[model samples]
Target chain A: MLDTIRRLVDEQGRLAVAAEAIGDNADLYATGLTSFAAVQLMLALEETFDVEFPDRMLNRRSFSSIASIAGCLHELKEAA
Target chain B: MCQACDSFLDRLFAKGVLHETGVDGLYGRGQAFEAVIEGMDRLITRLAEGDHAEVIRFPPGMNRALFEKSGYMKNFPQLAGTVHSFAGSEKDHLALLDNIHNGGDWTGGQGATDIVLTPAACYPLYPIVARRGQLAPEGGLFDIQSYCFRHEPSKDPARMQMFRMREFVRIGLPEQAASFRESWLERARGFAETLELPHHIDVANDPFFGRAGRMMASSQREQALKFELLVPIESTENPTACQSFNYHQDHFGELWGIKTASGETAHTACVGFGMERLALALFKHHGIDTNGWPTSVRAALSL
Candidate 1:
């Protein structure tokens, strides 16, 4: 799941730093992920994991870092 | 104009500051009102003089194709206004007149024109800058003012359907963009002080449309991308936004292919003065009569 999140970040995060260089707890926004890019990442995550992010989950905290994104995905899968 | 309507809107009309146009949010500004707008514009110019910003004045309408590419409709479809014109043959024209004569919907034949009302003063500038290729090593700064249109109509005098926005836009690296917004945020407060207007700066979000937009707005606020300097105009409890400071990151630069001297996508920021709203705030806080205003406030506006 961590590897997949990293891969998706590389693919859709549009971060200034390489996903490999970023720690799971790194701040994605501080590393240059804009709200626009975050939306792309959200869409990509939803498709890859077959999980729809609830409107309540659509916030900076839910997508702030690779670890947070993995945690969110885990919750969504469990709920599914 | 109401005979005893104590609302500021009615007061303005009674004082010959505004002329009612029958529409809720549309009104004609009398000479006194226009003079205040002019003074506010000059004050903004004086404040930005040291920046040596390139000045560009665009008409209220912008290219429809460019407007589509702007993603404005996607964000705020409710506020978007498109220009439409009657494009019909002689027979269609006759049918249109007949429909109008019958008091029917004659506007059905109107087609969307090649123009859309410009949503913001800086909307047209980005594409123009992109066309010029890479920016200078110092990046770019511009002074722009335009009458912008938003579809929301309200009885609030400050919330006009058509309004003037004066902006100073900066396009460059992230730090450059952020610092530009930071500086202007402070400068704007000073401006309010100079104008003797009670104001406060706070985090703000655009009125993006729909359920998805709520999330977008929260994210925007979280990122601290937008801020507004609010002043009491229509309601003291909920002050009207008189000035806005926004940092667009690399959104426009990426969309319009604008680049810095180093060939990276340039970030952008803008500080916008809601000219009409500020004028109204000045009148509300000080008084309708400019001569009766505080000597310092009048001196600051050079009124």
Candidate 2:
């Protein structure tokens, strides 16, 4: 799941650095993932993972890093 | 707000500083109120003279096509107010009048016009500058003032449906835009001191509309894209946002094809002064009568 998340970040996240350059817990925003790009990343994650992020998970923290996004996806899968 | 703060609106109306227009957030300003607003506008103009900014004044409405391209409805559909007109024939007009006379929905016949109310003072400037092609080496600086509209209506006099905004817009590189907004943060504090208005600056976000908007607004705050200079007018705890400095990173430029001298997408920034709110703040903090305002404040405004 972490690898897949990293792949998605590399594909969708418009970060200044490659997803492989940072750890799973690295701050995506601090690495220049813009707000608009985050929206694109969220949409891409939903499509790729077949899970919809609820309003409760729609926040900066939810997309702060690959690890956080994986954690949010795990929670969503559990709820499903 | 508290009960005491509610009385401030009543006192303004009673003192004839603002005339109630049978609407919650709409009011007519009396002569003294207009004078104060004019004085504040003059002070803003005087402070911005050093920048040699190009002054552009726009009407209350803007081209609907440009507005749609700006993507305002995507984020703030709730606050948009578009103009609609009765574009039907004479027979349709008669039917509309009959419906109105019979207490029916006459507005169903009204179609959307090509114009929408200007949401902010600088919304109209970008396309005009974009049409002019590339900016000068130093980039574009504009002084704009306009009557802007929002749909929110309330008893809080500071939150008006229609109000005037005086803004200085900067279009250039990211650093240039950031520095322009940064300078205003300092200049605004100085203006507040000269006017004797107690104020504070804080990271702020627009009231973005929905669930998706919540994330956008959070990201905006996290990135420090917007800031507000707040003053206590209706509520001490909440305080009114009398001025805002926003750094819109390439948003307007990308939408309008605005380009810097080096050909990169231009970043934009603006510092907007809520003209009516500032006047109300002065009235609330000082007194309703401008004649009785503090000596230093009066001198600063030349009132």
Candidate 3:
């Protein structure tokens, strides 16, 4: 899941550096994943993972870092 | 006309559209500037005559209590400018004078007032209309304008600390407000075409504050509540938003207790034009000479 998430972040995050180059706990915002690009990444995530991010989970903290996103996806997977 | 772009301010200075008053963001608008600005205003007035919006002109400063109630501070505390003054004893006045004479900071003794510089043209109207209870069955529309102040000091002529905002607001049901925005969106495009400025409308959000604000901005964009008509002013790569269309889905209605004729919270939308910024764009694009502008634009603006 992490690898797949990392791949999506790499493809859709529009970050300056590769996703694999960043640590799993590195802050995405700090790496220049802008608010504008976040939506694209989000849409790509929903498409790739087949999960809709609820409005409550659509916040900076939920996407703060790869670990946080993985945690959120794990919760969603469990809920499903 | 100045050939190089860096001398844009110099050109404005020569044309008397912008006058430097030794302040970074505060400057005087001369005849040329006012001519185009007021010309555009009159054009809008004629165009908006059909709407029959109640015209309300507010003082630049608003009541501090209302300002707080609007929660502008929560989202944009950094940009808000609060008026403060020195109210003190004779000795304190003497001390203030001494501090100023000695080049000290006398502003520290100043205190906040009931007034706050108007940040947006629509803030005061919501509560005022809300206090009147339920709206008419036909809903309400307002034509409001004010000199708004934001504490943004910059070298860019497009970004001013104080500027005028001409806005038309719609207060009513969801479908009505949405339609109002939709029509105005088209009208805005028409106005841009008439003015002969190269522009585009894009989904946008307010420059919210902090991480929470980041989320708010995203959600706002995701919901497509805000749109800005961006015109290339200072740079072609990054254009300035000369006009904005926003639909606040019951944010102000809930905060101000405004309701529609049906007794539900009113949905609100507004279209605002950054008067000076548009003029700046014209000057940048059409050169300082208004007469030299394309005849179609001149005829459209009736300049």
> How do these models rank on lDDT, best leading?
2, 1, 3
Please give the distance, in angstroms, between residue B217's alpha carbon in candidate 3 and its true position after superposition: 0.7
lDDT of 2 by residue, B102-160 (tens): 99999998999999999999998998999999988899999999999999999899999
The TM-score ranking, best first, is 2, 1, 3
Best prediction by TM-score: 2
Candidate 3: tens digits of C-alpha lDDT, residues B1-303: 436754777777776778998877799999878888988999899879899999999999999999998989877888999999888889999999999999999998999988999999999899899888899988999999999998888888999999999999999999889999999999999899888899999999897775446677876887699999999998999999999999998778878988888789899999999998999999889988888989987877778
Residue lDDT tens for model 1, A32-80: 8877778778888988999988888888789999999999999999988
Superposed model 3: Cα runs more than 4 Å off: A1-70, A73-80, B1-6
DockQ for every model, please.
0.43, 0.60, 0.12
List of chain B TM-scores, one per candidate: 0.97, 0.97, 0.97
- The Cα error of candidate 1 at residue B221, in Å, is 1.2
lDDT minimum window of 10 residues, candidate 1 chain B: B1-10
lDDT of 3: 0.88
Point out where model 2 deviates above 4 Å: A1-33, A43-56, B1-6
| Order of the predicted models by DockQ, top scorer first | 2, 1, 3
| Model 1 per-residue lDDT tens digits across residues B186-300 | 8898899998889999999999876557668889988788999999887889999999999998889999999999999999999999998999998899887777989998777
How well does candidate 2 match the true structure in TM-score terms? 0.91
Clashing pairs in model 3? none
